[model samples]
Target: MNRCLSTLAKLDEEGYSAPALARLADRRAFPPRLEFTRADIMEIRTRTAAHMSISGVQEKISLRLHRGKLQPVTEDGEYILKPIPGLALPRFQEDVPANENLTMQLAEQIYGIHTAPNACIRLANSELAYITRRFDRRRDGTRVAQEDFCQLMGKTPESAGPLYKYGASYEELGQALRKYCSAYPVELEKLFRQIVFNYAVANGDAHLKNFSLQQTATFGDYVLTPAYDLLCTKLHLPEESRLAIDLFAEDEEPESIATYGFVTGADLLDLASRFGLIEQRARTILNDICDHRDKARDLIARSFLSDEAKVVYQAIFDERLRALEIRG
Candidate 1:
């Protein structure tokens, strides 16, 4: 296996191949150099300033991969490329792209958590950026209508408050899914599974803005969008306790407390009932997460995260695994 954390494709005597990149991206060849220098990356970020509307402090630019080169796009971007964030806690900034790539792959490959298809892309300047294909955009270059949970719930900074998106519980997200999605039962289960997966991986930043309802062609209705921004946030914010938002409203239970408390199995069961999942269905999702521990651990070992970050990620996983397994 290529030790390079960016893509699964191997390097031969010639060099690292672009097979994975070719398959996933519009362009076949990797950027002549993963934009290697600070000056080059800064220039890309500057060009992207007008195009980026996504929330968060991470410096990223939406790009149109044109003729084997990533060109900054002010509109209709097909891919979002994020470099190691310039503004993040300490040492973790540099590793976040790889951390997210590893986490997204783990969710998709090991735990069956549907997430945005992503890979680590090397810049010509030697920088690494996490690149994910846009799930909302279609082949013809028309965008599928999609709304983040925040929009679905009518929670805007003007309407509710500055913290509006984070103010609601995860249960509220399920409620919105039920109301908006024509395929409620299935989406609800996916939502529940995602919560467990998020906890198991310590994605403390899986906030409302991070979840969306996308329009699928089979029916002119909404469904949970492919998961994105799924990184182990605990690696960066080690002291942070809460998992972005509450699992349920008024989730003041002692067990939900950070460090000592957790989003226990019972809490999930209760939420599952709210979403109308039968007992067996709920257990199946929980059991899958429990059963996949070894697989998850194995991937973490082979993950692209730095050695120190791997330890933190694994520790967070262990803590969440214990929380998910508890009967109460």
Candidate 2:
């Protein structure tokens, strides 16, 4: 077995120890983790393609996984398999587990309100393992037309400057959002709930790359995919930041979407109203979120995160709820 893989196995067998992992991380420039060999990468690609019929996988987005030679199984007609990076080990670093756990918790909370792709497995070879369901696949080997918010704004990840640049006022984007909601009323309502949930959880990283539109032949139109990559970064990052392109105009904050372009309470209500949700239903949803604070906290603790990470996670939840003035 590879040294990194062996170490990871030992760590997993013994259970996660934050102090030990921290020390190990300090000792090496790179995290003491395994890397998938070319053979492993090919095998994964072949297997995924065989099972799902994904034909091409690109090394876009983050280079970490691509470096491991693991391509996204785009040919898979049903799901996408995100191979774990060899160098990315599973440790309590930056509260990643907490983030993932939070995704699952939020999924359950908004059960009918939001739709997220399933997280099938958490693989651990030498480093962190993430196996998420592919939302861009169909039953047959066909490609789904999709566009990230960034692409719509003519920006790549590297070119993405300030969130405010791709402000919500872009007439095209506004029209797209309006059209998507008009056609998919049910899905749009769920998405609106997800936006509110992100704010309540203090997910300051909800930027354009995080949102996307899926085009399908059945509807012969484009619509937003179920929510994915939901992590509360407010607790992990500095203060007074958000992951929205606009503020207040859409939800509840007094700021204009063009000004302080973070998703706020004002944005949520605005979206709800657009989706035909009355004040009473919208308020009820907000109240339900406030009531689930304790639940979110408990779920954080239960996730595969260190105790300290849990505390940090919970604190963010508390702070965000208070900031939103959400009452249980």
Best by lDDT: 1
Lowest lDDT 10-residue stretch of candidate 1: 8-17
Q: Estimated TM-score per prediction?
A: 0.90, 0.61
Residue lDDT tens for model 2, 1-328: 1112111222433332443233222222322232453346546555544444332232111112233232343333232334322333234443553355455446554333444433322333433332333566553546678877666667753665454334453223444566654465554555556666777767766666677888867866777876776766555554646544443334344443454443445555655665566677777776677767655665565554457767777777776666555221
Q: In lDDT terms, how accurate is model 2?
A: 0.50
For each candidate, the alpha-carbon lDDT, in order, equals 0.76, 0.50
What TM-score does candidate 2 reach? 0.61
Deviation (Å) of 55 in candidate 1? 3.3
How does residue 321 of candidate 2 score in lDDT? Answer: 69
Point to the candidate with the largest TM-score. 1
